[model samples]
Target: MTTAATTETSAITETAALQDRLDFYWSGRAAEYHAHQVSGARAAIDRELWASVFATALDGCGREGSGALDILDVGTGSGYLASLLADAGHRVTGVDHSPGMVSAAQAAHPDLRVLIGDAHAPGILASSLDAVVNRYVLWTLPDPVAAARAWRTLLRPGGTVVAVDATWFPHGVDPAMKVPSADGEDAFVRTYDPATLGALPLGTAASMEDFAEVFLVAGFTDVIVKPLPQVAELDLRFGVAPGHESRPHFVVTARCP
Candidate 1:
């Protein structure tokens, strides 16, 4: 085989391996993930903030005499966001790549539907959704721009896409140090190594402008970026470590036009 073919094959193998590792990691921590999200005063505050962000985005989608809005929560580990939206009268479906995570979500919210699927390629019909919401998912994705483009295709005209994330680890931090886990499993988890963590295309390093640009390139309009004040306050009050306190978290919203 040619060198190009060999490189392509290697890349595919690496991608698959990385995905497998992530699947196993999340699967093992499903219960811990849900518990962290729903427990504690800080968790309650974060949920309210997330709900407000998503609720506002969904409301902007407009009913147009239609029934409830159809919302898809990509990477909906444990269905936290899905349940919140469902309770708010929206038709919610959650998709996760990890089978264990999906099972946990289904068990937690039997009323809500959660499926095992890749967030980057959620196999849903085009233009079938009114909104797609994700929280702390971008960092884990290998190709966020591709995922954003896919999300745009999933929404109908005037539909919205909302992503909530933060820069969990800044540039200077030692990757080996105890960093707050985005998966909600632990207050602090040890990293693999500096090289591995540094090589990751983390959303944490991407600024608000970076996210807005991706959405704009993906055919979205009315992009809005804002910080979650409540979340920032809660972080300061309940931060586990020095750098973890009041980390730069923001909510990005864009409309499919």
Candidate 2:
């Protein structure tokens, strides 16, 4: 009825539409994306670094004392990180919004139970998880702040959240082009819709502090951040996915309070 109400409603509708488009886009690219992720995971140096991070996270979250964790891997494209967590002796359940990605993950690791689910609203029971983890998924969220809040609710009290992401679009987004293989270079708009970039508040965050603040606002405590120059090194040695630029990634962890 009011002008302000109409504007707010329109913005919400538009953002939801944009998120649907993003899911479709990523689903279509699952094969290409999985190929890229496998290359990165196959790098021994990077694998070692991530393994160490997860090991430290398990200890930091008191998993070592409590026993293996019931970890939910949100936005688990291709179950790459899920496998790593399984290797760490955790009971891992993964959720992703993209069917194609779910299929890819299942195909790659038939043992992993990855379901079609949204990161912002995973539908997991409240306080049922010992940990929530993701990699490179936060930046793509239409609402990272809300997603962080939801993740906090999914974890039990004293349970921890571990996520790794980077400044992938610090200078703002460029059109993501489709590729044939891991190295295809044809230019086309597929990764993000420029008009919707504004809706993603953390999509182009300049620093790790921007990400850390989300959990802090969500009532998480004991937040810790560590820079991953090792990721940059992996990119330097093995090269990044086509259309992606290399930057230092960071692992941020926080405990539910």
Candidate 3:
């Protein structure tokens, strides 16, 4: 193979390897992750903020006038966002790369449709969805720009893509800094090498501006980026660990024109 071809092949191999690790990580923590979502006052407040964000994004997609818009929740771990959207009178289909996550989400929301699929390539029909929404998922992607382009293809003309993420570790921090377990249901401490964990493409985004650019380049228009006010306030009032308080979590919304 030529030098350029060799580089491309190496890149593909790395992405696949990283994806496998991610699936294993999430699948192993599926139960604990779901437990953390529903436990404590902070989690409740966060969920409310997510609901408001999704409602606004759906409204932007003209869902208020239209009835029950079809929304795809990519990387719908444990179906937290899917439940909220379905409760708000929208048709939701969730897709996750981890089978364990899919099963957990389905068990949590039996009525909701949840499938095991890659977020980078959701395999949904073109122009079949009014919106694609994900929370804390973008940073985990190996190629978020490519993922954004794939999601754009799934939306209708007026549809929108709403992503909720944060610059969790701007300074290239180690993943071991995270709390061992939030809910205490599963206390599995990650033993991955700090360097390897840090090198993962996830959480490398310096700012929301980088994400906005990705969306714009993917053919989205009228991109909006803003912090979740309630979350920020709660984070201050009931502060988390020392380092986590400063992480700026924000919502990014871009419309397909």
Q: Candidate 1 — which residues are off by over 4 angstroms?
A: 62-67, 172-192, 195-199, 203-206, 240-245
Q: Using Cα atoms with residue i matched to residue i, what is each candidate's TM-score against the true structure? A: 0.86, 0.89, 0.87
* Candidate ordering by lDDT (highest first): 2, 3, 1
Model 2 off-target regions past 4 Å?
3-9, 39-42, 62-66, 175-191
Cα TM-score of candidate 1: 0.86
Q: What is the lDDT of residue 137 in candidate 2?
A: 90
- In the predicted model 3, the residue pairs found to clash are none
Off by over 4 Å in 3: 1-7, 63-65, 175-178, 181-202, 241-246
Model 1, 65-113: lDDT tens per residue? 2457888999999999999989889899999998888988999999998
Best-fitting candidate, measured by TM-score?
2
Return model 3's CA RMSD, one decimal. 3.3
Q: Is candidate 2 or candidate 3 better by TM-score?
A: 2
User: What is the TM-score (0 to 1) of candidate 3?
Assistant: 0.87
